[model samples]
Target: MSESIDIVYEALGRYIDGLCGSTYIGTARGMVVLYRGAEIHHLTPLKEPLPFLNLFYRKGTVEIVGVWREEKSEAFFLRAAAADVRLFEDERTISIITYPRTGDMQERGMLIITLHANMGMAKTLKSIIQEETRFIKKEEVVISSRVSI
Candidate 1:
């Protein structure tokens, strides 16, 4: 069964695209990774300025966060938007880059996922994130009244 475990990753690709359906699968280390095709953004340095001159460290994890739409758990209620979901990170050192979370946090924090994947896989992931980052206008209307003297 271990030798055939490759299906897990394959399922993940399809799952993100809605082709895999509801049942979720965890990684070898007991964690499930997910993404929203409509909420990713390519953050510029203005928001996350490259603080200091790097002497050695270079590679970093790709960060993402949103309403969790995953397995059932207690953390679901913590998310302000949807009571049914919450975001989290696994202990996989090579895959996720997480930082300390603090205070009365309602929103699920970043995922810091990896982009150092195969070209096809990386592109698929990138596309999902990119599509969501596109700007779409929303219309708003305001009402006003005039007073007669």
Candidate 2:
């Protein structure tokens, strides 16, 4: 795990704590902490060198998305539908989106986590796709910015 990943995990832990208010069980990996299982805090602890984005919620499910740079190209990771991942690079910043299961989305109690290096870019991306999909519906987006520690 890298220092960046540790920082991101700490931030995520704080966010999760605020929402669910439940004690979290996290798996430590070097400097990174990967959320272990279906547990909110254990769901996704990034490995390393990945920046924070934001969380989004649609209907009842939660989604976590983030963008990072690898080999000079933007890499996108979506913790949705088995983690939909992608990569991109250009004048615009990269974006990633994850949707929850259909049943969960319809429940309107899910939470979505979206992370990115740029807050403005993340927000714009979220607004653009907020209604374009139903993978995760009736949920809220938790937005977080990435910073070097």
Candidate 3:
């Protein structure tokens, strides 16, 4: 892993150690999932969609919706789907935002996490969108000014 990715993954490792449930970390290349306590899974994106039980949509600001999951023999895999994998070809992305699923929510949604890889400097987080239960949306300017690249 690169230095920046190491830093981010290190921080995320600490966070995941304390979570009681599963959490996913997506990158431009693939996904790293922490299931329960110490079970970790690395998954690659599937070109075609599968018959997944829990389907969700991954969308970016560019309006491209990518298929994000695949299931085979009762195992699940995830990909950082954004319509096209190449959309993040030049960027090093680490997903930091996601909406919590609720029973009453009509549709599943994902928040955009776009990061530009600037090896030794901090990258800017752009176009973060959050939706409320009342249908109100709040957009933040920058999530963190110190996200190392």
What TM-score would every model get versus the actual structure? 0.23, 0.25, 0.23
Model 1: pairs clashing at backbone N, Cα or C within 3 Å: none
Candidate 2 minimal-lDDT segment of 10 residues: 23-32
Q: What local lDDT score does residue 146 receive in model 1, on the 0 to 100 scale?
A: 12
Candidate 2 wrongly placed segments (more than 4 Å): 1-38, 46-48, 51-99, 102-111, 130-149
TM-score of 1: 0.23
In order of lDDT, best first, we have 2, 3, 1
Best-to-worst TM-score order: 2, 3, 1
lDDT of each: 0.22, 0.35, 0.26
Every candidate's CA RMSD? 19.3, 15.3, 16.8
Better of 2 and 3 by TM-score: 2
lDDT of model 3 at position 13? 40
lDDT of 2 at 12: 57
Angstrom error at residue 80, model 1: 14
Give the per-residue lDDT of model 2 (tens digit) for 1-149: 65556544655554564346422212111111222234333223355644444444323233444434444222222234322322232343443423333343333223333233344544444443553354533423332233211
lDDT of 2: 0.35
